[model samples]
Target: VESLGRDGLAMAKSLNMGNIFIRKKDSNSLVPNCEKHGVKAFSIEAGRALKLDYDYADKMVDGLLNFLRKVGILEGDEETIESQSVYTTKEIVPAPISGFFKPNATLGEKVKKKQRICQVTPFFKSRPKSVSAPVDGKLIYLRSEEVVSEGDSVAHIIR
Candidate 1:
């Protein structure tokens, strides 16, 4: 059961993207099949990008190796792999009215409460309505689509 992870969602490719959940019994069956074939498998959720941090990539590799060791595919001491905890309290900023969105904040940038995050200008109007952050947090993602409907999600903030 392969699926696009959170990175795909960050790219705006799919609406439902995150960790994949499997029933415990199903997972029990799946693990043995992978073990029999000497395959180590796991899932990860991350942001979308053309390039990734080298340090993060290395850590992922180390984590995979540790998983292999735990599942009997390899024999070694369990290596400690540190991972950054992801904050899940996300704020989905919605469009106040249908318009073309001009974002002021970049992805992964820190934002303060009440900061202007974007502006939405209706196609027929010259004035744009400014959107502000409701809480202090980091900008997790911004909508790639310029045109949006009223109440559509314009950006996501992680507090």
Candidate 2:
């Protein structure tokens, strides 16, 4: 599992995308399910839901070709990938109330635990609740839309 994860990270680095290696596997995910049966597998999550990123698609093709060669599945010279940064999203910052969300921290920035990440003001003129980071980590995800419902995930922190 670790070997394939490193290769996946390498593929990401070779493609010039943000490199990530998720250390913990969820039992419901395909990779973990396959692992249970002694099958080596890795999953590639790319692009966005209901959207096709053409530029990323092209690079992914090249990266897959290189990966195939590296694994002896294809006959060609394989490219060596540089060391990559490994991180995992373990926590998500949720909106405290359905309201307009105002982010206090920028995405990709490192934040400390208990640092205020965003504020969600209630629609009925109530006091805004501050949403904070639960751990010291890099801000990995943030909602782009301003409006958020209570309990909706507004951001994620990966360490």
Candidate 3:
């Protein structure tokens, strides 16, 4: 598991923003082979609701232990692991024109199809273009940069 800010931007280590979940078996069945070589693997992506804290650390540890148990590497009672669904399809909203971006929704919030999520106002005198959600899903990422160029990714909604 790895933590990243909205828009997949690298954040300070202290900030536990979100996680990227890549399945161990989604590709070439490498996870099983790696395990034969004494390596462990996971296939879930988790996003924290807050910054790095004791609660977050504890949850991580518990998740690790539970995973080990599930794979028969550790012996223990079965525990239900709460996790977020992995989304293969993502709606990436790009800037329509060069401008300053102002966001209308918080990161990780649920958005409906066609919802207005942000606006891009050009540095000059042109009108601002409102950015809308393309699908009903969770807003996984939003650009933190104030200025954006045309075609720059502004938001990502996972469905």
Winner by lDDT: 2
Evaluate all candidate structures by whole-model CA lDDT and list the values in order: 0.68, 0.77, 0.68
Q: Which is the leading candidate under TM-score?
A: 2
TM-score of each: 0.56, 0.70, 0.60
Q: Candidate 1: lDDT of 76?
A: 88
- The backbone clash count of each candidate, in order, is 0, 0, 0
Q: For candidate 2, lDDT tens digit of each residue in 83-114?
A: 65567555878887899998999977889999
* lDDT of model number 3: 0.68
Which lDDT value does model 1 have at 102? 95
For residues 1-159, what per-residue lDDT tens digits would candidate 3 score against the true structure? 132334222111112223433322434676667767888543433444454557757766766676556556789854642334545467789999999999999988999999999999999967889999989988877888889999999998887
- Runs with alpha carbons beyond 4 Å of true place in candidate 2: 1-18, 36-39, 51-59
Q: State residue 45's C-alpha deviation in candidate 2, in Å.
A: 3.1
**Which ranges in model 3 have alpha carbons more than 4 Å from their true place?**
1-61, 82-86
Instruction: In angstroms, give how far residue 30 of model 1 lies from its true place.
Output: 16
Candidate 3 local lDDT, residue 158:
80
